[model samples]
Target: MSTQVKVKNRLSSTVQSLKPSGIRRFFDLAASMEGVISLGVGEPDFVTPWRMREASISSLERGHTAYTSNAGMLPLRVEIQKYLEERFSVSYHPETEILVTVGASEAIDIALRAILDPGDEVLVVEPCYVSYEPVIRLAGGVPVFLKTTMENQFKLTPQELETHITERTKAIIFCYPNNPTGGTMTAEEWKTLLPIIEKHDLMVISDEIYAELTYGRMHDSIAALPGMKDRTILISGFSKAFAMTGWRLGYVCASPDLLAGMLKIHQYTMLCAPTMAQMAALEALRHGRSDMERMIESYRQRRNYVVDGFRHIGLTCHEPDGAFYAFPSVASTGLSSAEFAEKLLMEEKVAVVPGDVFGESGKGHIRCSYATSMEQLKKALERMERLMGRLS
Candidate 1:
């Protein structure tokens, strides 16, 4: 019998060093416990609209299981082009500038990988969606996190943005109708930051995943601004607004050259997004606006209730103008964010994402999703108030 020799571990250093997603950890804990009310995930609670679902089903029924062009189905791309022009005032040649991706997640990965070289720096504003920093590291780029504060409603100031740029800085990822904080920026705010971007010659990776869900104002895409179309990589998907998370369909729009580079990487890796999903997304663009608007209005009402509930429970919460989360400071409870989250799950059967997982700036706060039903949000708030009472 030959003896097998023990080999040295050979996982990639970057992948090995990445931490597990904190949002998923708490969510799994809640899943294991009986009767726990979970507010950990950022996903919408609604099902994909019937028209979109029927479109996907009809495509599947017609045996449309074959792969599309790596850039995705041409019809879907064309519809995307029309949607972008009509809604965001950004125009791109559907044939050359749009690369349909598996999800906005894949769009972010391929966009960064296409542009970043080893040791290149990407300024990442935080507290952000948990994936940005890790994705940057995986793409051989350094992530420089610019932490935003609650006092400023978590919007990144021009001075703070300028202070973080250096010669090595190549791009900046900005998300609005932002994750975790639900912050939205006006066109004027975008204008305030554009001069610095032009001076630095930095590429903007704008993640507008929650664009349609904003309250009190329309979303402003930096790509829509004069002279920015060539430098901005605009990313969005049908997941949030159309309630199609499991559909996993998204697209990236950029100048032809930049998109071509990303397409080369995507060709070898993803090849193409799902044909059924593309069909569904096409239907979403054409006829799903009314459904999306209804969901947005529901989210707006829930957002108000959740923020008020948090404040009533003695936690300081800023009004979230976009997205479906309420970020509330738990500093008065005298417990660290993680401690509060763990204890709340164990003792009160309520699960929330600890804010610190987003970034250091998010410490002393917790993120509660208002995406669930109103009854559940009320129940979660009552449980949180009970937990606060115990802590006191």
Candidate 2:
């Protein structure tokens, strides 16, 4: 009888059932509070590399404001092809295999939507990027979470995946140099997964946005494995490495058949990624390697500092292999993940994401991004130490 009831009825059950992003909620709350030091949102604290920004500006000056082709500008796609092949040892034909999307986020949405039919099941690794399960549900697919343990360094095991697979299982979404937890797999680790994937004939949607941000060793893309090129749809973008988050540039590389289906969805829904963003991406590929190196060097330093800081404060932290987060257990404090995060925010004005917000396995931990400056990280850590001392 009420207008609110009518509006609620009109909303899709899928949307209604979906939980809001836990990361965003804390980040927003931190934003509203003065002097809150945030280690919550998984974003690079750096500005977009100047060359990429200048390239976009030059494109605007040249009046390149029109929408690009549905697949994106040829030059940008070519550069992306070259970059991926050279950097990751995975090759995709620029013309047919790549489609630039608004961001990797959009690429993820369309990839799932294009492949999934009603009731198909998708295996999602736990403590993943926040969007995976909700997007699967939105695509009319069932999301089956496979828990990854801290004891195993949060890397998804083929054995764990095998336990979760069933007749309805269609695909698996994997992220490495993962979010929430900065776990990564070596090429040898990927080799073990190859047979399981082939035996099950499962499609792979590999999200490698943080590939370039690894420490010590270069990122190893699973798509580089023999026989994987056709079955894997690789999603990545300039947002992480190039600090071009606001540019909304990303792309997906897949076999032509799969790409065509995703492009069909992309063309009708998004038309094309922004023309200017494509130009910037082109420039980033051409000239941004050094910029990425500098940022990575800074992150490596920060990572070491954050990890040591957590340990010195008497919390158990797994040293992240890549990405800019230190996921430390607050279990010694005798508090739940949410309780620890909330109390830290209230008592110390430091904001870190609650681990369980990522998945059930993340219950005793909190994700603290080291993306901020050394000074800020030091201050946040000091505040955390004070909180721990008082509690102790």
Question: Judged by TM-score, which candidate is best?
Answer: 1
In candidate 2, residue 185 scores what lDDT? 93
Q: Counting only residues 3 or more apart in sequence or on different chains, how many pairs clash (N, Cα, C under 3 Å) in candidate 2?
A: 0
Q: List the residue pairs that clash in candidate 2.
A: none
Once fitted onto the true fold, the runs of candidate 2 whose alpha carbons sit more than 4 angstroms away are: 1-8
Worst 10 residues of 1 by lDDT: 181-190
Superposed by TM-score, candidate 1 places the C-alpha of residue 375 at a distance from the truth, in angstroms, of 0.7
lDDT of 2 by residue, 69-140 (tens): 999999989999999999999999999999999999999999999999999999988888889988999999
Q: How much is the lDDT of residue 164 in candidate 2?
A: 92
Candidate 1 per-residue lDDT, tens place, 1-392, comes to 99999988889888899999988889888898899988988899999999999999999999999999999999989999999899888899999999999999999999999999999999998889999999999999999989788899999899999999999999999789888889888888889999999999999999999988999888888899998999999999999999999999999999999999999999999999999999999999999999999999999999889888888889999998898888899999899999999999999999999999999989998998889999999999999899888787
lDDT of 1: 0.93
Over the full model, what C-alpha lDDT does candidate 2 score relative to the true structure?
0.92
Which regions of candidate 1 are displaced past 4 Å?
none
What does each candidate score in C-alpha RMSD? 0.9, 1.8
